[model samples]
Target: MKKIFLLPLISSLLLFNCTPKETLDETFQKINSEVLANSKAYATLGEATSTIGHRLTGSENGAKAEEYTYDLLKSYGLDVKYFPFEVETWMRGDVEVQIGNLNKRNYEVYSAVSLAHSPVSADVDLEIVDMGNGLEADYAAKPGAVEGKIALVYIGILPGSPEGTSNLHRSEKTALATDNGAKGIIIINQVDGGVLLTGTASVTGGLIDIPAVCIGKEDGLALKEILKKSKKRAKITMTNTSDQIKARNVIATIKGSELSDEKIIVGGHLDSWDLATGAIDNGIGSFAVLDMARTFKALNLKPKRTIEFIMFMGEEQGLLGSRAYVDAALKDGSIDNIKYVMNQDMSGNPRGFNAGGQKGADGFFDKVGEHIKAIDSVAFTNQNSNSAGLHSDHQSFMIQGVPYTSPNSNLDRSIYGCYHSDCDDFDLVNEEHIRNNVRFSSMMLYALADTDTLPARKLNDAETKAFLEGNGLKLKLKIGGDWRWED
Candidate 1:
């Protein structure tokens, strides 16, 4: 009888110990179900927008936003920390722009706003030289045309430009104008119906000697027509403020249970252009990241590699916040431990992921995409891309040879017209779309964190230079003074 009892107890113990561990597929499914059922991304963003409004770095609203995210992450029971940094930031002030013919007393006042980093005080009246497209080739076409005068350039490439012409950023155009000896610049907004846009005009993030401002598309075109009839002079008078300020970047860490030494960073800029609420500009991206952290904690996930969810500030004025973080990482020698970085700036409705020119990452993401597709075949089509671009937080890491990727966004075309404009409000966001960002991106983040080994490794100096050149970003980097390689 004793032997039979002992045999039955041994069989029960063996059965209890044989329970299977959860697979990645099962975890992904759970993530999808949990997000679909209970996601606070949309609601949290709504609260922040309705209450805090635009989160411009170094502003009161910006500080509030920082604290808000910090508290939320703390509520999620994650290891949260604030990395503070000092930066000289620029703010908009009073401005006035007028246009009239040369040698005329009266001028036609046009609706315009001063671009960020404009002169602290400026009063200039000069002839408006229309340099088409504002490319170096355009400057070559018209020698000494924009010298000591006001330059008028289109915000986008003209319709009849060369077939392979690449457009420059507004800041780059301003830089070209300054380098060509222009006294001031008048950028024509591309949007129709008198919509003016404002962003940073100085590439160096320092106060520019000449004033720069933007005018409505209709007004600009009408001014162009008048100039065709006769020469016109533009008067840009503005007063901006530049001061030193302190800003903080919020980082929430989910420590890995197994491979704690390896790290994956998922970050988005919490700061936005102060034209409007910045709801679509980054509300979708940053808030989605916040909720992803919440989801990971709620599910009690412990990936093999640690993940750091960061909300970066000072992105609109420049990449100040992310640059600070990367600098700190480099100083501490923990930069090598960072294996991957995923940035989501203005990202929504993820159709696929971009490999960011990282070698061997395409196959890795493709395999992971299948699991995402299993969750929602229609929304997540698993079509990945291998493109890379600049003017985002990822550039800070990409330059350091850390591999990066982002969701291939499919935002509405209409909404894009409001970029850096006043129309980027909470109304532009769709609930299901932002939810999709959280679901799909969180899955990708987990896959990178929990995988046995990452396919992409940190590139050395030569390999990084080759990657940038191949992606055609070398010229842009040189233009922005970010090129580290010798020409």
Candidate 2:
């Protein structure tokens, strides 16, 4: 009699458990259809690049881009909001360099560019000291030799790093150079054919109290050869203008139908370098986010958990916008509500998604990836991966013990010469690429939000520290002076 009574209850429980997955699978179909049929990601990217140009953090073009994105999100009639923050604006001025004796003060004028946040005027006259790769050990090897001299380092890691070794950020290299009392820093660009790259050498947004500049590979090598025969001295004259200005982050909210407290963040930064239109660097990723918001509104698709579509600013200047967002949320105790984060920086043509956490996230990502592939085997077959990398907005969320996601894209490497250069224009963008990203990413977002029980959980303070150490980042963090845990 007891077994007979329990049979009906067991069947009811099974039906209840399977119902949400069925609903989620069906909803995923609708989202993919809506995005594929009518996704304006490429068109909107074209418009944004043509109209506002490169959206620098504190420039007039930056303000225009902010307004454009804000108005576009406002059109959806969702709960759109703008979070503004102050950033120190950095801009370039006349830059000049020459090498040789003071009689002529002229050896050759190779193409050189100024790094951001350098001193207002650098009229330094000093001898050059080549520090290979600018690794920490290089500074330690020659104590008291770099003071009052220009330290020259390669912008990219040389071709000789061991298999298990990782290179530090360019700014971190700069920090090491500055700590050793170097009067200035000269970074050599890896791109051939006289391509000069300009980026912030200061790890933090603040100034480094030294002049930083980048020269081409050919020119840098020529200088090194000249140093071999005799002492090589040079003169550098540069002026960088800066001011404090307000920047904005645009956010659009779609409330959950059932579980209102649980939230997910879909984020991308809108700021880019002032050299070109930045069409591929960020416009594709961020405009795709904007199009996703439009698609959700057009289709009236409501999931079980809330979604926040965010456009950050000041990413080119060291992730100031995303850091501000995370700090505010933590201060107000709203960080507990967030369950997942999807960061789309420089993303294009999604082949799959990256599960950015420990091994526990693998099972959940495999289920979702397989289900999507089943819908369209030709497109999403064998595309997803369970991997992670640092140096994007995802780092802000990951450090807070949140699981994150990013597009596993197959980008072309030939055009890397255009990155941070004046050639990252609209010509590099593809129509099909942006559309594909929108369709696939929209499907993934909906599925994540609609699933009944998410597989990931937030780490406690101790657990978060353990995760960072386990990932083998403690040494890198210690070198960069970001280590918070004591021995």
Residue-level error in angstroms, candidate 2, position 416: 3.3
lDDT of 1 by residue, 1-487 (tens): 9999999899999987787768889999989988999899999999999999999999999999999999989988989999999999998889999888688667989999889999989999899999878889999999899999999998888788999989888888999999999999999999987878988898777887789999999898778778888998988888888999889999999999888989999999999888899998898999999999999999999999999999999998889999999999999999999999999999998989998887668998899999899989999999899877899999999998999999988778888888889788999999999999999999999999999878688988899999999889998888777899889
Candidate 1 RMSD to the real structure:
2.8
User: Which regions of candidate 2 fall more than 4 Å away from where they truly are?
Assistant: 1-22, 101-104, 137-145, 159-166, 478-487
lDDT of 2 by residue, 1-487 (tens): 9999999999999989877544656777877888778887887788889988999887899889999999988876767889999867677788887777545455666678888878878888788788877888778788867898989888777776545545667788888888899888888888887777877877656777888888888898777777778776667899888877789988999999888788988988888888788887788889989988888888887888999999999888767788789888999998989899988887877778887756677677678877677667666654666655566787777778888888887667755787787678888887877777787788888878888767577777788778878887677656545566784
Q: Using alpha carbons, what is the TM-score of model 1?
A: 0.94
Worst 10 residues of 2 by lDDT: 101-110
